[model samples]
Target chain A: MKRTLRKARLLLGVTYAEMMEYRAELYLWALSGIMPFILMGLWAKAAGETPMGMPPVDFVRYFLAVFVVRQMTMVWVVWDFEYDVVNGQLSPRLLHPLNPVWRYVASHVGERFSRIPFVTALMGIFFLLYPKAWWVPAPGTLALAILAMLVAFIMRFVMQYAFAMLAFWTERANAIEDLWFTLYLFLSGYIAPLEMFPPAVREATLYTPFPYLVYVPAKLLAGQPVPALTTGFLVTLAWGLVFLALQQVLWRTGLRRYSAMGA
Target chain B: MHGEHYVPEPMPSLNGSRYAVAWRRFWLSSLAAEAEYRLNFILATTNSLLALAGSIFGLHLFFRTGYRLGGWSWEEALLVMGVFTLLDGFASALLNPNLNRIVSHIRDGTMDFILLKPMDSQFWVSARHFSLWGVPNVLFGLITLGYAGKKLGFGWTEWAQGSLPVALAVLILYSLWFALAATSVWFVKIYNVTFVLRSFLEAGRFPISAFPQPSRFFFTFILPVAFLTTVPAESMLGRTGAGNVAWAGVTAILLLLLSRWFWRFSLRFYTSASS
Candidate 1:
């Protein structure tokens, strides 16, 4: 276990060093992540007139929390996986004893580590900018919220992994990524709350795990508790398991098709 | 990492013959390149349509609840939102989309390719990306404005009188794009800057008046977002008078000239990786 942990540490250092070499390039995407902050500003102002549900103050806290959770939970593994899988890059990973998923998650987690400081500073700004709305929650709530957020990130990344593997079955996997991105933009509480959505649409989301990925954690962080984390975390665990299984299924089916086709 | 940029002194806006030639060359080839990948073009267009639908969906939902937002009735606010879309289309269509890839150039040290050519580097970079796919949104936005205006009870005469200012609003919008795009020199991570600017653009969809009085004040003078979509919509609706139209034109021209100067100024700070 110590050796594995050390190996993980070494991997993260190497990845961060490699990425930092093109720091400006990585910043391009980091900059794109500012979209959530922008949306927060617009909606916060609009909702502040008569808050979304709680109060004007509630909208402020909710959006600011959402932004922080968003920055923390973000990952681009699905995108990288699609590109790599379609290009036959996965073959080398399969050859190795190491699980490729751990490596990919390590790289992403390293990137997220670098970004967390920025979001922490942003939370400070959020508090300074809206003193009345945003505040520190109780220690227990904060702990639960953090755990839910971690579960949410796990849920999101796994779903992304499964969806991205669809590249094996189809060409132009980037298109699939784009489709999922659009869904996340609206459905995952990135744009608006699940509660704000139309009834049927919100109902459909209950079956899907989209809310656990962002909305639930943001809701928790915002002091709302949101359908309660006890249920949410268990559901997130279920979704993650399902996604892991689906990825294996898809890979098996695709590899069989590939071999039969004499590729 | 040697050849990156050449600072040629600006020639007066281009004498007639060469200017006409470049203008003609720009469109003819851009369409050809875009046409080469029909499916990708179709998919890209579809993607843009989805983005457009997202914005429109918000507006539809807002009005579905009530008639007015920020004191402007649904028709008025919707018109402003359409103008926001149109101006956004123009920016992404021309300036922002084109000039934005400079970071890619800087990182790869490939900007030298453009610098090697006799054409001006700034001009070449500014006119680089031509996504004709953005054109439909402009047309669609205008159609939306037309529909909304009819619902709100406005006519062509109102638009004609407002066109002069709406034209100015176009220039201002373009200048803002150019100004921010040039900041690739300092920030080098220009994409995030563009996103932040876009958030302000989103703010312009609703009436400036809808914001708190302080934000309304800041939006007009400090950010000038009010002029981006709202002022144009107001004029084009024939709701505003000549003074506002004149102001839009002056602001546009001033901003345009300012952005060009800043682009030149930023060029001085740019030390390409190749260099």
Candidate 2:
């Protein structure tokens, strides 16, 4: 266990150093995630005129929480994995004592670390612009929201990694991820809050893994009432397990295919 | 010998017809190369359709609550959405496939080859690739525009007048993308800058007036996103004054010139990959 911990420390340290070298690119990526803010403007406007069960300020806070949670939970494993697999770069990595997945995990964590200052700065500017929408959550709520964000990140990573395993069979595996992302963008509460969804649509989407990704953590952070907090966590866990199992199976099968290709 | 001077002969400029031929050859070769990926075509079409459906559904959510987006009726907002999709299609088809390669060319020193050519470097880079993936979005966007136009009782004259702004919107979008892509010379790792621009341009999916005062101002004067889809939709609906159209034309021409100037300026900083 000590040895494993030391290895993880080295990996994360190295990746974090690599990430810091591209600070400007990282800032641009953080700025690219301003979609939630744009939607916040639109939703806040709509909610002002119509009774959408939430006030304009609530919409503001909700989307602010969303932007934060999304930044924490973003995943792009499919693109990287596809590149490595297609270019035969995975051959060298397969010789490592460690599972290759750990590298991706460490890199993502390092990027998250690198992003903290920029994300905080953006949030500062946002609150300065709309100070009325600012409020601190209770300590307990903040703790739970942080936990939820971590789990949501894990679930998203596992799902995209599973999709990445398709690189074994296809060159354009990222295209599949693009399709999945389209669904995620709409149904994952990224575009609008679930409260604004039609009643039937909201009920239906709850059964999918989409809402638990963004809505649950965001609502918890925004201090909005999430009626079934335990249920949300359970569903997130369930989806994570499903994707984890799928990824393991694909990893074994894909490795066999990789070796068969004379790699 | 010290006092002797040599004068170089003037090279012939390639005119419009030569450029037309070159454009055709560039697209045909790219199309042939891309046609090998038949499955990709299907997947791309499906993805575009799904995205369009989701956008319409999202717009419908606001209308279902009896809130007209920026005081636009449902059909009018649909027009805006239609124009946004069309521009997105144009980007994906030409601008993305071509301009996204600028960073790689700069990184690999392949840009030296492009510059050595007799043709205009900007024209060559911007017209190089034509992907088939975006054709579906183009078709779907036109269908939506037609359907919405019919619902709004738009006549042929309105469509004709609207085409001018739509064309100008294309020019404005191309300039913005080219200028952003040219920044790769200074910041080779900043490939995602265009993505940042794209996210900001997402505001064009809605009518500009739908946003709050500050947001409207930002989209209008700062980014000029208001000229992209909203102005064209307004032209089609006959809600915009001739002055708005004139402003859009001016903005398009000025931005085009600015992008041309920016490209030349950026080239000064482009030390090829090795040098």
Highest-scoring model, lDDT: 2
Candidate 2: TM of chain A? 0.97
lDDT of each: 0.71, 0.91
- How do the residues B194-220 of candidate 2 rate in per-residue lDDT, one tens digit apiece? 888998999999999999899999999
Model 2 DockQ reads 0.78
Off by over 4 Å in 1: A17-53, A82-96, A166-172, A228-246, A249-263, B1-17, B60-67, B186-193, B270-273
In terms of DockQ, the best-performing candidate is: 2
True contacts kept of each: 0.11, 0.88
TM-score of 1: 0.83
What fraction of the true Cα-Cα contacts (under 8 Å, chains A to B) does candidate 2 also have? 0.88
iRMS for model 1? 3.9
Q: Where does candidate 1 chain A have its weakest 10-residue lDDT segment? A: A254-263
Candidate topping TM-score: 2
